[model samples]
Target: MSTRLRCLLAASAVALTAACGVGDQAGSNTVTMTVWTSNQAQLDLLNRLADDFSAQHDGADVRIQSVPQADYTTKISVRLAGGDAPDLGWLGAPDAVGMAASGQLADVGPALRNDPEYRFDDFVPAAFTNWRGGDAVYGVPFSTSPFFVIYNKDAFATANLPEPAELAARGDWTWDRLAGLARDLQPSLPRGHFVFQSNEGSVYGPLPVSWPTLDPLLRAHGAGFYDPQTKRCTLDSPAAAEAVGTFHRMAFDDRTAVPPGAQADFYAGNAAMTITQLSRLSQLEGAEFDYGIAPLPGGPGGQPHVTGQAGLVVFEQAPHKELATELLKYLTSEKAVRELAEFYPPARTSVLADAPEIYRDSRLSEQAVKDILVPGITEGHAFQYPRTWPEIKTTAQPVFDQLWSPGADVGSVLGRLCGEVGPLLKQAE
Candidate 1:
């Protein structure tokens, strides 16, 4: 079985069904659009906004479906490919181009252009690049959230170590120092706890196609999976190997980051620090300890900050494209964007400027919002990924398991990965 399918199977046994419906259809008019997301908070918030949307649009209800993040992109991509596209949905920018090229996405440009008051131009130009071809816009980013560090304040206090906030204040927060801190704090962490956790903590899994699994570290080292323009794999480069090697050393040698088969979580206070983004803030509610948020550590690559993007798109096969477009406009306008900034962050330039205040009611303090969150979104590059990312992730999985073991040859493992993905890249060209 393919790794992606296995993810679906495993998720189904322990998780919710594909479309966990939001609420009752507004006034029984039935759901007009079904949007998919991996975030519970976002699902709830979008459902609330969708309620008002339904009221305004003759009671055309909108359903927000929540899926497990582990298999979300795969499940939704499979659905779209199987002729069962949602009327509208939350799609990752990485997958937008490929889906658009495959004729799976509808060009939303016309509806956007027809309405002058919508302020489509208010969106950052870079936000639309992956989803556009000339005047054709396949998607508009609803979330341009950037990756940052979330540290357990209690862990820092217990270890007698400076927190991320202090490090950022001293201009000493960088990945190298982070590595040292992970090790230095290890002896201080509770018996079963660690010092760091990577995004999702599934860096290398069952089948382990480990390509972009370590991309954040790759970027921190000024390396990437491949050169976008050339469509060539760079996973075997020295910098790339060194970055992955550092994580491996942390996992096996230092025993700091949660390893492949571990069960610790930062939000649960089992970890001292973790590299993650905002949507995860929902996990912090009513937590047992205070937590500090800070920018991703700087590195030789100079604080590699990559904004993870999700855009609202109307699928081509959607039955009510016009209505879907209208709902899209309503949900992404400046007013709605400001409201969404409380969690998802915003792509609208006007709304982006006022993020700190918009999020004042949330758990994050204004300084955290201004110093860490806003800059990561405003100045960070939208994660530049190949249109072939889904293919690359699937095809490269099996080859990555080799490098997870102690003393595993990083260079050789990544070389094999490059070989596995070479055919996929060539086809892209």
Candidate 2:
């Protein structure tokens, strides 16, 4: 076994031995549970839930220890191996497959199946599936966020460009169309005032856009990054080439995208559109200009897709398993989900149906779900598996960075990158 895998197993062994059942054998009224999480905003929300849980359960106390985003995975792995793992800690959904293979988590399906209040079927299938290894469910999804396209309505009207909704319905709003619009508007606006981010490292504008939009386009074009049946990597296919080509042209060749070095362009009203998450809408309050949210446009494949991150998982060996599961159940309820939907999009279909006011003002969230996230789930989803995703982070970034440079050959650069990285992805298997 690999060093990392060995470490994970050792940690799981300790966790499994340290705790026996859900509660203390003496049946103590008070049960203490430990939690680990990354996002401060989410931690706050969970804190509120903890308060509510403690109140309802009479003598239960929940203690939370937050880990910084950068250190979460490493810390959890070490803790699990060393037999010092916290009960009910957060686990990354991307690592679900690999972790489940390590046999660290308790099978939660049987417990949840017997509880009517939990309503396990209400969650988005993708989120639920990602938390389960097979018949067993190791974790319950607390939150899910999908990427969407946000645009300036006034700018679109000024340029006489069609609203994204109309264009999407007409099947006329392709990536090329959006790029062309940016190119057309570029001449009228100041250089720094155009599309704020066309290319950047995985961040605010360009990087987020590529994950949710461009990556999906590859899937629509019939590219398979990994062959599930064969358990192999195939990221160098023609579809991948085409998808990267489009992004290269849009960010560099057409000069439609603003460089990240010019951050002032977006806040200064020079840029027109951006790719962002719905949770980020809070930052746009009291903007000087009128902006609108819309779903990202689709490709020739006739589908839009998005990349997302899943939140909150309970540890299998948690001492207070019953209470933790109860708290988790409450966390996913309509009331709790609606509260979270105020900041982040809820992963439950019921919450989406019940909470109209949350997304009422932000048409972006509504449209993006209908256009991007749902389609991605229904058609096929794509994501970098946790074990080998580091390869993509290291290799694909330089290629993307070069695309923003003047006179760079995006195709040759990407072709070389895929060739080099494909082997690495295969090695992880």
Evaluated with TM-score, which candidate comes out highest? 1
Q: What range of 10 consecutive residues in model 2 has the weakest lDDT sum?
A: 1-10
Clash count list over all predictions = 4, 6
Q: What is the Å distance of residue 201 in model 1 from its true position?
A: 1.4
Q: Model 1 clash pairs?
A: 174-298, 208-397, 209-396, 209-397
lDDT (tens digit, per residue) of candidate 1 on 203-286:
766332232236567887888888867888898899988888889889998999888778898888888877777777888877
What TM-score does candidate 2 get on C-alpha atoms? 0.76
CA lDDT scores, all candidates in order: 0.74, 0.59
Query: Which 10 residues in a row give candidate 1 its minimum summed lDDT?
Result: 1-10
Q: Show where candidate 1 strays beyond 4 Å.
A: 1-31, 37-84, 133-135, 206-213
lDDT per residue for candidate 2 within 1-429, as digits (tens), equals: 100000112233344334432223313333333344356686677677677777778746565555554556775677667655445655655655566657666567776777877677777676665666558787766556665566677777777777666777777777767767777776666545665353123432433235654565555556645664454555556766676666666666666665435454343356777766665666576677777665555666655555465555556656666766676666667678778776666767777665445666664555555656444434334364534555555666665566556676646666666676676666666
Global lDDT of model 1: 0.74
